[model samples]
Target: MGIRSVLSKPLAKWVVERQREWMYRPAEAQQRWMQRLIKGGQNTVFGRDHRLTDVRTVEEFRQAVPVRDYEDLKPYIEQILNGDSDVLWKGKPLYLAKTSGTTSGTKYIPITRDSIPNHIDSARDALLNYIHETGNGAFLDGKLIFLSGSPELDQKAGIHVGRLSGIANHHVPGYLRTNQLPSYETNVIDDWETKLERIIDETIDQPMSLISGIPPWVQMYFDRIQERTGKKIKDVFPDFSVFVYGGVNFEPYRAKLFDSIGKRIDSIETYPASEGFIAFQDSQTEEGLLMLLDSGIFFEFIAADEYFSDNPRRLTIDEVELNKNYAVIINNNAGLWGYSIGDTVKFVSRDPYRLLVTGRIKHFISAFGEHVIGEEVEKALTDAMSKHPETEVVEFTVAPMVSPAEGLPYHEWLVEFATPPHNPAQFARDVDTRLTQLNVYYDDLITGSILQPLRLTSLPRGAFQQYMKSLGKLGGQNKVPRLSNDRKIADGLMGVVSGK
Candidate 1:
C-alpha cells in the first residue's frame, strides 16, 4: 500500500468521528461553545455591559445583547487598537485582519489567541474530511501550492496587521510547509504582478498535486502556468487532483477553470471570511457545505425578509428550517458579539446541516423597486452564458441605471470577456429572460414597463482588472461587488473602459 494511504487512513477515521459527533448533537455542541464564549468574556467591558455574567441561557443572552455591524463595535475595536486589553475579550488580540470595509475606508477585525486555533484547525479538518470522503489523499505526497497574499505584516499598537490569507499562511503546519510552494521571500513581496511572475518562474516545473486560492486569482495563475508550459494543468502535473477554493461563488468560473485544468478533479468549497471560517464541504455527495458546529463560532439566523425589520426574529441552529434564506449572525471567540457579517445564506439540508451562500445583504439593487440581488444576477448570468457553448464570461458587474433625466431606469452590465459571445445583444436578452424568470418582482417591473431590459456593454479586455488595479485592490481577496444599488461603481467601470 502507498505511504499516503496508510498515513491518511487513521486521520480519515478521526475526522469522520468528529464530524458525526457534531452532526448528531449539533445543539449540544453549540450550547457548550456559547457557554464557554460567554464565561470566558464575562469580566470584559463588553460582557459586563451586556450582562454576560448573569446570562445563563440562550434566551437571556439574546435579550441582553443586540445585533450589531462593524460600526457598532468600532469604538471597542478602536480601544483595542489604542493598546487597551480586555475591552472585548479576556486579553488583547494577538493580531488584526485588515480587510475592505463596506461603509468606511478599511476594517480591522480582531484575531485573538483563542480564535487562532479555529482558523488553523478548521482548515486542517477540511482537508482531512475531504480525504476521508473521497479517498484521494495521494495529493498529500506532493507539493501543494497556495496562491496567497504576501505574508509581510505591519504593526499597529503592538498588534500585527495584514490580510487574512497572509495571517493564515503564517499558521500553516510546519510539516506541510516542507511541501508548500512559493518561497517565503516570494510570498512576502507586496506587488502582485511581481509576486505572480516570481511564483510562476519558481514552481512551473515542480510536481504540484494541489492548488488552492480564490477562483479569480487562481484562474490567473492557471492561465499563466498554461501559457508558460504550453500544456493543460493536468498534463503538466499528472497527479494534480484537488482544488480548494473560497472567497466567492464558483458557479460562474467552474467551467472555465475545469477547461484550463483539462480534466475533472475533486473540488472543495469553503465559506471563509475575514470574520471567521464558517463552513466547508464535508460530504462529497451533498450540494451544500456542512456547517462547522464544533468551531468556536455560535451561529444565529435571521430570515432575510425580516432582517431589516425593527425586531427581526433570530433562530438558533435548533430552530432554523430548510430552504429558507437567512442572514447569518455570529458570536465568536474572536470577541465579536452578536455581529451581522452581512452575508445571506439558505439551508439546503437540515439533519446534518448544510447551506449555500445566496448573496450579500447590502449588495442589491432596488432603485426602481425591482429588488434584484446578487444571487439572482449570478444565476441569470450563468444561465445566459450556458446557452452559448463557445463563449465564456471572465468577469462582470451589474448596476442600476437610475438616470431619470436621460430615460427610464434600466440595469447596466459591464462585462470583460476572455472569449466574447457571438451575439452580445442576444446574450443580453438571454440574461434578461433568466432574471425575469428567477425574480417575479423583476418580471413584473419589466412587463409593467416600469423598467427596460438589462443592457449589456461588452468591455474591452482586462477592463475589470484595470479597474481593480486603479483602486489599488488588484488582487488577493479583493473581488468586485457583483451587484450594487448605485451607479458609482458602474460609472467607475465605464470610466476605466473609456480610458482604455
Candidate 2:
C-alpha cells in the first residue's frame, strides 16, 4: 500500500468514531445544533424578524417562524444579493449556490463559513465510514473523478456564485487534490457533451479508482467510454472500487449501471441539496442514509399526507416514527429559517436516524386522489425487474392519463429500456400488480372501475436523453422527475415516441 493508503485506515476509524458521538444521540445533537443556529441567527435580520432571540425550544422556534419555501425567503435573499451583510446570517455569505427554480426563475442559496463544513466534511465522512467498515482505503492511491458542473464561478454581491458542485470543488482537501481527476481546464468546459469528451480524453488512461456523480450522468460517461474502447468500465479502470452518487435515487439505474461496469461495486448514496448536505449512507449493510444531526442544521418533519394542510405539525427527531413519510424542513446556520427544501423522506431506522429519500413533496401522481409517491413506483418497478431478470431499464416517468381516447383514463408509464423485457406485457402487468399492493388507493380506484390498469409506452432508446437535451438540461445534476401530477413531461415525450 502507498503512504496515504497506510495512513487512511487509522484516519477512517477516528472519523467514524467521532461520527458515532452524534449519530447515537441524534435528538441531543439536533438540540445543540438548534441552539447554535439560533445563537448565530439572533443578531441577523431574519432572526430578529422571526423572534429567534426569544425562542427557547423547538416548538417556540416553530411558533415564531412558519415553514417557508424559496419564494417566502426571497426577500431576505434579495438583501444578500444586493450586497447586504448580516441580512440572513451574521455577515455576507461565503458563497451563493445558484440553482434552477420552478416557480422562481433562479435561486441563490447561502453557504456561510459555518455551513460550508457540513457539505465538505459530510462527504469525507461517508467515504471514511466505508473505509473503516470494509478496511479498504487503497482507492485513495488512484485517481478519483467527480462528474460535476463547471468550477469556474461568477461573482454576485461580492460573493462567489456557482453550482453547489462547483463551489465544493474549491473545498476539496489538499490530501486528495493530487488524486482528483479532470484538469481544471477540462472541468471548466460549460458544455456538458464537450466537457464529457474532454474528461474521457484526460482520464481514459489514468488509474481511476473512485468515481462520483449523479447516476445518469455517470452512466452516460460509461456509455461514452464503451463507445470509444468497446470495453466495460471495469476493464478500463481495474482499480475502480467505489461509486458515490446523489441528487436522485440509484435503484432504477442500478442494474444498467452495474451492467456497464460488468460487476457490482461498493456504492454510497447521499442526500444533498443547494441548501445543505442532509445525509449519507454510513454502512453498506444499512437500509438508509445516516442523517447528520450535528451538521449545523436542525431538522423538522411534517407528515407527507398532512404537508399541504394548514397548521401541519412539525415534529422533532425524537418524535418521528419509522416507515412514515415526512416532508423535511430545516433551520440552519446558513440563515435559512424553517426552510422547506420540498423533499420527503421515511425513517427506516430511528435508533440512529437512518432515512430513505421517499420522493419530492411536489412530485407525485394524485390526479385521481390516489397519491402514488416516488418510493412506491420505484419499488414496484424494482420488484418487477427482480422477477424478470432478463430486463434492464434505462429511464422512466409516470403521469396520469386523465382523458384517454379509449376506455377509462389510467396512469401512463413512459419507459426507456436498455434491454427490452422478454415478455413486455407480463412485465407491465407485474409492475402494475406490485404498485397496487404498495398503494391501496390505486387498487381501490382500479377495483371501482374509476381507472384502467397503467398503460406502458415503450420509449425509443435515448428518448429521455433527447428530451432533456432539447431543454438544455442534458447533464450535470439535472435529472428527469420520476413522476409528475400533470402531463407536461408526458406530452413533451410524445414527439420522441415515433422511433419506437
Q: Which candidate is the best by TM-score?
A: 2
Q: What is the TM-score of each candidate against the true structure?
A: 0.97, 0.98
Global fold similarity of model 2 (TM-score):
0.98
Score candidate 1 by lDDT: 0.87
Which is the leading candidate under lDDT? 2
Error of 2 at 339 (Å): 0.6
Task: Give the per-residue lDDT digits (tens) of candidate 1, residues 1-500.
Answer: 45665688698888789679888899999999999999988999899888898999999989988999999999899999999899889888988999888796789999899999878888888899888877788888888988888888999999999999899999998768888989999999877778889998888888888899989888888888888888998888888898999878898888788889999999889888878999899877878988988888999999988998999998999999888788999998889999999999988887889999989988888888877888889999888879976677778889888874666789999887778789988989999999999889999999998898988988887788788888888778889999988888888888988884
Residue pairs in collision within model 1: none
lDDT for position 387 in model 1: 95
**How would you encode candidate 2's per-residue C-alpha lDDT over 95-147 as one tens digit per residue?**
99999987888899999999999999998988988899998889999999999
Question: Which ten residues in a row are the worst by lDDT in model 1?
Answer: 1-10
